[model samples]
Target: MLTMPDVRAPRLLCVEVHEGRPLSFLTETAAAHLAALAARSVFVPTTTRTRKQYRRIHLPGPPAPYAICANGGHLLVDGESDRDWQGAVARRLAEQCAPLAEVLAHLERTAHPDWTRKLRTAEELFAYVVTERALVPELWLKELSDWAGQRGWSLSAQGSKVYLVPRPLTKSAAVAEVVRRAGTEVVLTAGDSLLDADLLLAGDHGWRPGHGELADQGWTAPQVTALGERGVLAGELILAELLRRV
Candidate 1:
């Protein structure tokens, strides 16, 4: 929600690939609005990215005091993973879901190499398949989703990565921990994917852009606004609306 999806956009790029590929862009207005929000609010970045991947983007603001990474498998406090939180997550996953090894083996058996580029495990907490998005069959995805759901897991496809994550590990769970520590009551959130559903629901108010899995699925709730704006413009609008509500 914070960066442009298109790499070739003329807008100023604030997020880049480690190899300097300019993977994502952010407009100046969005940057300014984000800075303003950071000055007044907690401004935690909740993302599905791993810690290493999340660190690659440099947004305009003071570094966030806390961040939720790896879809809530890892919680970072001032850039360091909290061991206690990690241990708790590990315990929950062990008890509530099929083992990661089982999930990885299933992917290896099912994923077609013609479309699947790589199968990866992130933070040893979840598995994902990197595939050619267009070539990935919808029927195959449905089968995989169904298979995962039966095993106390879930699937989400964002961009080229198809994530297989345990149902117990969620951004909202991590956010609740943060809220408990910070003693905050009101929560505002913005996201565009099915994976973000829990976080959006946990928030007192939320927003989702007009494009993404949530948009395609026509997902919304009483407190969440489905914005018409998309791409980097949607990012700016989200920050502006967050500031207004704050």
Candidate 2:
């Protein structure tokens, strides 16, 4: 086991980050305002997506302390990836289930050539994905589930997309590891998708923007404090509420 310093929750403030995608809605002016409230912060951006995808998008300012990438697979301190954390993650993946080679083989077979845009795997987290928004067939999700289940995996379909992931890999699980290292009083969390449901419930309290997978399905945790606001407004509202509780 990797030895770590004792960390108390940071007043329990957490957010499910879908890369930096949601932040793109806010103008530079609005983003600056939002960043100001969370200064000197430890932002745990939990996502099912990978770190490279998160880096592709830009946010307004640097998140102080650290920013989580790859759905918590990587906890970046001052923008540098943590080696020890990643090592532990690697160990978990090995013990968990299907190997990357096995998953990729299944992906290659079941994925449609015309619609498949990307086939990605994070060996550290033991996850795979096939994203094709416009080319999805009506029965794609059901078929994907059958394929994944046969291989002892799970599939999740978010808005305009689908994901193949292992049952042991979860965003909230990574966030919990970060919290143990942070040594704070609480954790505040937010997200708009079903992958985020775990993080929302895992935290002391959370916030859900007006859109994304969970919002569409009307999924809300009792403590998550779902916001009715939409788009940029939702981003603003979430930032504001997080500061209020902190």
Candidate 3:
């Protein structure tokens, strides 16, 4: 989390419970700003988290009507999977990307146990592993990216997690669907990770904090502003920025 001894951001009191314990927070100022934005505009959270994981976050606002979860593998409407959207996404992946099973098999064959800790598949749309980032070899990641690319997939390492996702499954595509449904002409977005690059690109304007994979890679587009804040402080600044624009 970003820490500044001289500057204090508002605290987000416990707003969500996970495994019977409190989790997920944003600044009090961010919470208020988001509430105001939600009241007037379409506010959709596009994330790489699975549906169950995403549900753990209780942002300060009315329940969002739409959310893109599983990095765009699933679309939730009123907290329930929209079957039509799911079907469309599945079809797109089937037509354009290699099967998740193929990628998972390759991972099982090539991954070294020394660094790989936990392997997971999200909605069978993508695969990822939690590994010791320092222990993971640079050449290995490059090789994996090259191998996946040929198979119509992409690999991204964010902190301790390395994701192998299908080329067709993306947050931007899901966000576009939400915009079409909402009939909105303007969009503002913020994120800090590589998974969010497509989303940031899809937005009219976007912000990225100075941490996460996108920051490490010096990633940006014409409409995206890269900020210097990191961690929780970055979240605060991103929300504050979004509020200012919306």
Give the candidate number with the greatest lDDT.
1
TM-score of each: 0.94, 0.78, 0.94
Candidate 1 per-residue lDDT, tens place, 1-246, comes to 434346655356556577857687777888888989999998999999899999998988899999999999998999999999999999999999999999999999999999999999998999999999999999999999999999999999988989999999999999999999888889999999999999999999999998898998999999899998888888888999999988
lDDT tens per residue, model 2, 163-246:
666655667777787778887668888888766788889889999987777878888867978777666557666877776776
Clashing pairs in 1: none
Error of 1 at 65 (Å): 0.4
Report the number of clashing residue pairs per model: 0, 21, 0
Selected candidate, larger lDDT, 1 vs 2: 1
TM-score of 2: 0.78
RMSD, candidate 2, Å: 9.9
Worst 10 residues of 1 by lDDT: 1-10
* Sort order, lDDT high to low: 1, 3, 2
**Tens-digit lDDT string for candidate 3 (107-224):** 9987899999999998878999999999999999999999999999989898899999998899999999999998999989888777788889999999988888899989888999
For candidate 1, give the lDDT of residue 204: 99
> Which candidate, 1 or 2, would have the higher TM-score against the true structure?
1
